[model samples]
Target: MTTTSHSNRDLRDEIRDYWSDRAATFDNDPGHKISAGAELFAWANLFRRHLGAANGRSLLDLASGTGEIALLCKELGFAVTGLDWAEPMLERARSKAPEVTFLQADAERTMLPDASFDVIVTRHLVWTLIDPKAAFAEWRRLLKPGGKILIVDGDFVSRNWLTRMIERFSGSTSHGMVSRHQDIVARVYFNRGARSEAVASLLLEAGFENLRIDNRLSAIHRAQAHLFSWRKSLLRRSEHRYAISASAPMTTKE
Candidate 1:
């Protein structure tokens, strides 16, 4: 699949359709859902530890498929809004968490009001962005002064020959979105080598401050390898994943 052959609109539509098709079974995937009680507790604790007090904080869960993180935030007492482009995915999210607002919008170009959210969270989303820098800017614009953006992502495609061989065999057993769109995976800019420093720099360029990378999420994933084994099995899977946090500067009121 040559990127040159497809227009930007075409690529966007393909991505939307790809995610829409996977919406029905998305939560069924072990890595995507917090099904077990222990897993749920661990994830809740992780969010609490990072996000601090959730009371009165407004959270925007970008690319919030099936309301996983959004629902979690709602449960934690934060006013939550789930945003995604795929209607089918939003539909599932709405079904699961009707109390939380779910909007169908582009993550890179949300027409939402500036500085509206106290916190922004996204998981497994950055790699799919056509322009991560632009997306970061948009996210920064959406955050309130002192607001934080938490991202969970990793480099999924840049790998050695042995890893590629392993992925090929692993993908054969998984039916996730990454496995079905190997071509898109190869073309994604972030998949090339989106390191932590590079992403932090992008955030800084977008006017975000106090950048930090948390490896606890990665450690949890590593401990429960089977929980995310499907991701590794995918042809376009990340070798490692971590969480990044950056805060919008506090505005000075004259």
Candidate 2:
């Protein structure tokens, strides 16, 4: 988690406060929470496809608000650690899954030990990063040699006409916090949103390889569709969302 400053206060503080305020009701949104259902199975299936079997592998979930993804991975036999900047979100996460080691830390420079995890994962986090390249570099440093990273993100700002209309008709809303989205957007790297190609470039620059993209994100959308109205479901499924996976290079022992 990071922030931008204005009027003597940084965007970091603003974002932290905003998410903390929303922490209580965060799971109310369909995509935000994964309970027992087809949606949960869909996520498990997707992770299995990209990550193979968990097999007690150590995994880190960056920006792990409420720890849902961490818990899912844990259920799949991962030694999961959930990291976030918001304590309120971590608190909720802790209540649900005490076994996970939840840390309140910055995602960009976690300062955790090197070669600490076999896999790293995040969702909807890249677009908000002020220094995504730095974050990617840090993530690479954190992973063991030949480890993998799974990024679930999108260019949330740039939308087609149909998406715009659907969003407008759906009247989508955030956590009811003051609408500082544009203000934060102005300071972040991906103001238009974290498109796959742009992010792939960053990953390559950061020394990650084997870049793979999940264009449809069909499994997630299909699972979440029933939770919303028809308009909202269409909007969700039709959005330009995606997932990307990249690998840290293998190193030979000296």
How do the residues 175-203 of candidate 2 rate in per-residue lDDT, one tens digit apiece?
34536666777767898777889999999
Listed in order, each prediction's TM-score against the native is 0.87, 0.92
Candidate 1, superposed: residue stretches over 4 Å from native: 1-6, 171-180, 222-238
Query: Per-residue lDDT for 96-178 in model 1, tens only?
Result: 89899999988888999998999999988887888888899999889999998888777665687767777567635455655
Return the lDDT, model 2, position 41. 92
Off by over 4 Å in 2: 1-9, 172-178
| Predictions in order: lDDT | 0.80, 0.87
lDDT of 1 at 131: 82
What TM-score does model 1 achieve against the real structure?
Answer: 0.87
| Candidate 1, run of 10 with poorest lDDT | 230-239
